[model samples]
Target: MAEGKVDPVHQFTIEPLFGTDHLSLAGYNIAFTNSALWMAITAFVLIVFVGGGAKQALVPGRWQMAVESFTGFVDDLLRANIGASGRAYLPYVFSLFMFILFANMLGLLPLALVGLHPFTPTSHFTVTGVLAIISFSIVLIRGFTKHGFHFFSLFVPHGTPLAMIPIIFPIELISFMVRPFSLGLRLFVAMMAGHVLLEVLSGFVISGTNAGALTFGIAALPSFLLMVGICALELLVAGIQAYVFALLTCVYLNDAENLH
Candidate 1:
C-alpha cells in the first residue's frame, strides 16, 4: 500500500502486469492485469482441482469425496429450491459456486507476507456484475423461452385486486429489476470490506511494532489478534457469500422455471 503503512484499498487496485503500450485491439488494451492474473489463477486452480476430482472411485478417495460433498451440497440446495429439474442445471450452478469459493479462499492467502499480493477479483463490481448479469440472463432467457409472455406474471402477485394492479405492478417490477445490482453489490461489498478491514488492522500491527516494545505489546498484540480473528471470520464469509450467491441464483431460476 505504502512505505511503512498499509493502504487498505491498495489490495483492490488493478494494474497491468505488463506495460500497457504493447497491445490494443478493438479500442481496448489487451494488456494482462494483476486482476486478470488472479482470475486466471483462480480458473486454472478450479480446472485442475475440480477436473481431477471428478473421477469416481469404487472406494471413493478423500479428494473425490470432498468434491462430491461440495457438489452434493449444491445438488441438495438446488433440489430443495428448484426441484427435480434443478439437476439439469447442476453443471453450471456447481461451477459458479466453486469458482467463487476458490477465488475467495485463494485471495485470503497470506502471500503478502512473502512479498506477493493476492488479489480478490470478487471485490470488484465489474467481475461480480458480469456474473450477476450472466445468471440474470439465464433466468430471463429460460423464463421467456419456457413460458413466453406468461412469464410477465412474475411481477403480478396472484389474488391481487385488479384495482391494485397499477400500484403493485410497478413496485414488484422495480424490485425484480434491482436483483442483479443487489446480487453483484452484495458480494462485491462483502469481499472488499473484509479485505480493507484486514489491511487496516495489518497497518496498525506494523505501526505499533515500529514504535517500541510498549506499543508492540499494547497496540500490535491486540491488532494482531483481531487480524487473526478476522481471518477466520473471512474464511467463513467466503463460503457463505458463495453459497448465498448460488442460492439466490437457484431462487431466481425457480421464478423462471415455475413462474410465480
Candidate 2:
C-alpha cells in the first residue's frame, strides 16, 4: 500500500472536493474537483490582480505596475505580430496569456502554504485542450465569416504550381487541423513532466531519510539542489509556454485575416 501510495503520478489524480461521490446536474458532472478548485483560484487571482490595478494614477504601485507592464507586453506582441487589426482582440489574447501564466506560476507554489490541493490544471489535457480549441474556433469563424470559401486559400501557397497545389493542399489542411491538439499537447506534456519530476524527487527525500540521518542529508542535498534548478527552469517554461500559446493564437488570427 505504501509503495502504491508513493507513486509520483498520484499527484495528477483529480479528487472530488465533496468526496468520492460526484454530483450531476442536467446530464453534466458538476462535481467540484481539485482541478476545478485550482481553476477558481486562478480566476480569483486574475480578478483581484486586474481589479486592484485598475486605479489609474501617475505613480503606480507594484501591482499596478505589473498589470500595466503585462498589458504593454501583450500590446507590443499584438502590434508586432498581428498589426492594427489585432488590437480588437487585445482583451482576449491578454486574458488567455495571463490565465495560463498564473496557472503555471501558482502550480509552483506549495499547496500546503495556500491550503489548497496541489494541482496544476494546465498540466491536464482537458484545460489546455479547451483553450486551444477555443482559439482555433475563433480563427475558423473569423476566417470563414470574413473571407468565405476563399479562406481555404490559406492552405495553399501563393505561387505553387497547379500540379503541386493538389499535393500541398491536403498536407496543409492536415497541418492546420492538427494545430489545436499540438498546442494543447505541448503545454500539457511540459507541465505534467516537470511536476512529475518534482514529485519523484520529493519522494526520494522522504525515502532517503527513512534509512539514516547522514544518508538523508546526502540524498536530500543533491535532490533539493536539482529541484531548485528545475523549479527555475519550470518558471521559464511557464512564461514561454504562455507566450507561445498567445503568439500562435495571434498567428492563426493573422492567417484568418490575411491568408498568411
Residue pairs in steric clash, candidate 1?
A: none
Give lDDT per model, in order. 0.92, 0.89
**Candidate 2 per-residue lDDT over residues 1-260, each given as its tens digit:** 23423688887898888673458888788888888999999999999999998889899999899899999999888888888888988999999999999999988887656565567899999999999999999999999999999999998988999999989999999999999999899999999999989888877777766657886789966787888999899999999999999999989888997787
lDDT (Cα) of model 1: 0.92
Candidate 2's displacement at residue 103, Å, is 0.9
Q: What is the TM-score of each candidate against the true structure?
A: 0.95, 0.92
Clashing pairs counted in every model: 0, 0
